[model samples]
Target: MKKLALLLAFPLVCYGLTIDEAVEKAVENNLQIKQQEMEIEKSRYQLEQDKNLFMPEFFMDFSYTTMKDTPYTKLPAGSLPFPLSFKQTNKDFRFFDFGINYYIFTGFARIEKIKISKLDIKANRLMLQEQVNTVSAKTKKAYLDVLMARAVVDVYRKQLEAVQKHLERVKEFYKQGLVARIEILQTKVKLSEIQRNLRKAEGELKIAKAVLQNVMNVNESLEVEPVKISLPDTLNIEELYTRALSNRSVIYSLKERVKQINSLEKIELSQFYPKVAAQLKYFYTDQYPYLDPKENYALVLGLQWKFQGAAPYYGYLKRKTENSKLRLRLQEIKNDIKLEVKAAYERFLTAKANLNVAESSLAEAEEYYRMVVEQFKNQLASTTDVLDAESMLTSARKGREISYYQLLKAYVDLEKAVGGSLKDEK
Candidate 1:
């Protein structure tokens, strides 16, 4: 009984998840990231297959045959005695062959194909990185939302408590005939409003937690640690644009696409040239026909060229046009990135200023509320005045909470626009 009582007396502890930890969990578990990784693996395998085009291919063949009649040469009726005939081949025979085939030249088509495959692999990897960055930014924003909701709930709870305490004071004053009956009624009304708002805030907090859990792809409930509002001390717009251009995976992926297009163009150009191949073979047969060797080895070289109604030239032209389009697209992406960085930077600055204003307003509201409460106790202020002061204070607290989190979110957006963490910047 004593052990049971001691166990019941202890409080359950839950560790809080940090923003970085949440982002890591989200990235590690996201289905899109997993799919992108698979795509990269597939491209790597394709690269291996392309490289194998340069290596020799080994082959073997076997056959057994039964003829309906023996293969023979018959003498002409007037030239032969007694219509004689000579057997040329056995009725039943077996044959076997072994060979190696190699491409001596394919106008460098194989080399270009290999280069395109390698570029594909690099492009897929960059896409994966881009996906990771997107997920990380989303997770951070979700985490901040949870923190903001929790803060709002706390503010509402405190407001509820204050209103309840004031109601009791108002009731006491009414009993002593120091205040009017309407004072108690007004106080009751304020207390009820706070209770309703508190409930709403609580519900919002639950939703925020659920959203965070869903983003992290976790089954268990999450408790996130409160984060301090810390803005970067300096931000250079030009430097940020430079970092975004250099570090963004999308840009790099596009560049890889350009390289792949170049390789493809080369491959298409090679199609106009002839292909040369060599084959070496060893053969054996159970029966030999006239002038046929029972077993032998041979080396052969072959060349092939086809004219396909100007198709090769047209294909080369197509690839060249596509290459030009890709380069233009790359330039367009760079321009968009610069614009994104600029917008995010401006938002961060706005949020920062809003936070500063909210901080000052909150302090002033707190002081004003305290003074109004004191005045009410001395009968110098009415219940309406007290309620008004409390309302202003509640709004101020809520504003401060919202502003702080918005600033954090804005900073996260800026980091996302920069394509990496700003803290890593020198």
Candidate 2:
């Protein structure tokens, strides 16, 4: 229980990073990840707004009109006199109206729109998850790159030391009149080459650290130490493909899109039915010597129907057409996802094979270099033989590092293809 407590508090501890810590930092500080989080929040608020569609809306309005002269209404007198007259309007007047409008029926359009808004929220969340996964994968790749570059530097450093020693021994032989001057010149050339390679390796290591620092959203230089890459004895492609279909964010987002489209189809179906709304209003008007002055209120029911336009039908038909297209697009995406997973898996297997070969070659080269060194100490092997063996051994060591890094990179790609974390298996 104590250990678990420490584990739960691990994020509070600051020190050198592991892969998981690097990923956590990236998710917390990366701009793209934060942007997606904001997008999810925006969608959540929009969903809340959509839910308010069923509630009444309040409005207040005012109007004023001006005329050149006072007006009067003239009514025809049937038998008593020539005409009847009454004051009807003021030259200038103003009125105020306040009301609450509520919908009674919308042919289920409001409900369907709300459902679609909910799906949009889900889609935004899935997009955020997708961004998280992308950042995680890229962080791991950068971490591995730092390690690989550092290893290359180490390899070149060791080779430079070995060649420097050989150059000194060659000069000593020339002084003793045992080797020719040309041999010394050759050893100097080899030493210069190793020095150049070491410098280039150092430069590469710095660049790799910069890339890693950028990915982590930090400004400090890094001396990164990461977990060793491991591969399983066997993998089942079918199992991985199945998990990807269920777990991938793109697929799930698309599924939500299909739901939204279906909801829109239902919304368009409402075009055939009348839209009904209820309203309550209160009004106040003051016009001197033109009409009676009193407070007025009313409750009204209204019905609206459209029968002439083809717009709603066209909208519904468009969604229906896209429905078939969406399904087809989803199937295409699945096939593409399967192909990506399979290709990455194949590369992983190839990298593993290459690593095996490189390891075996390193072992053989080490033994050969040792034998050659012994022979040179006994004056039985020529300087050329020793130089060749050392070069071959360094080459093999560099090759092994390259192969190891490639294998790790390939594993990362495979995990990304599946849109999940595969390091747990290791």
Candidate 3:
């Protein structure tokens, strides 16, 4: 009969959502996921631009110059035995040049550049994966929180109804002169207290719902029934530690950063070597209308070896140092995750034990309440004793829900520590 009453008390909410469905919706609509995807495309475009460095590049040039005065190379008055005549030209000059250069070598710098861009794309992909896991974990927790709050409301309402029935019994006893009038007054006070508590629980339920909706990025208020997610059947902390070390996306992305550093170091080393290039050029010049030169073209070979200050060498060494630090940091992350798995496993076990105790205590409290009520009806027990029994029962039930919800949250944390979704947890 209690079960039927609990069922009838539940509001028939229209929407029902599983945790997995919520995770899917969060990932699909999440802005960070879109940004990471765009970064991948940006890397690809950068790769194309780097490759274009080796392709033929064309350019054109035009220039005009004017001096205020005509100038001539004048001989000293008696510097040479032969007679000299001074010549002056107009102070205007114009020219045009066109060329194409094909850069063929950069001490393998081009090859390393391509590799770095590719690694960037891979890193961005890992970033997307990490975002998905993070969002999914949050969604799972929030979704379960709504359910936990709902359960608390339900528990409070049921207990409130039971206390109301007790209040009526006490009133009847007072009318029969079997109980003092103070007993009826005490019962009414308890009823009012439970009603206030029930209101708080209902308000909490609404807040939990709002929190879940906010996570899902929905504007409309939803009436969702969260499907219960069961705890894992078995937990192996050591196994989870090993899996997290191997499968965590954060570690993978850091490893990719290490790869990028290595590629950069190689490219920096390539800068010290000589580079060869081939070029083709054409030009035309006209000092005056009657002195136009023919269209001229040339094929040229080029070699370059430039010296850099000590800063570049220092940068190369810095790259090496950065890679070393990242490797150590990755190892540190693994240690941290191992510690998390251990701690979460312990909390889960504790919550599980507490839940068991709460369930047993609830049964005892209910039996005691029944016996106390019967004694009160028979004029053998005081009304205060019956009220105390009912209070104990309510406390036991409330404790049970608290423990159960704590276990739920701990289980979610455990899954996160293992670096995966609850459904696929090992």
For candidate 2, give the lDDT of residue 392.
Answer: 97
RMSD of each: 2.8, 5.4, 5.5
Q: Per-residue lDDT for 198-228 in model 3, tens only?
A: 8999999898888888778776666556466
Model 2 Cα lDDT, one tens digit per residue, 1-426: 999999999967656678788889888989998888888888888889988999999999999988898888788988657888877866788889999999999999999988988899898889888888888889998998888888988998898888788788878877888778987788788888888998999999898879888988988655666586566777788988987887789888888989999999988878888999999999877655645655689999999987568888898999999987998998998999999999999999999999999999999999999999888767788878988999999999999999999898898888888998665542
Backbone clashes for every candidate come to: 0, 0, 0
TM-score of 3: 0.88
Q: How many steric overlaps does candidate 1 have?
A: 0
Worst 10 residues of 1 by lDDT: 286-295
lDDT of each: 0.91, 0.86, 0.81
Model 3 C-alpha lDDT versus the unseen true structure: 0.81
Report the C-alpha displacement of residue 228, candidate 1, in angstroms: 3.1
Q: Output the better candidate (1/3) by TM-score.
A: 1
Candidate 1 vs candidate 2: the lDDT winner is: 1
All candidates: TM-score: 0.91, 0.91, 0.88
Deviation (Å) of 410 in candidate 1: 0.5
Off by over 4 Å in 1: 1-12, 65-75, 78-93, 285-292, 424-426
Per lDDT, the best of the predicted structures is 1
The whole-model C-alpha lDDT of candidate 2 against the native structure comes to: 0.86
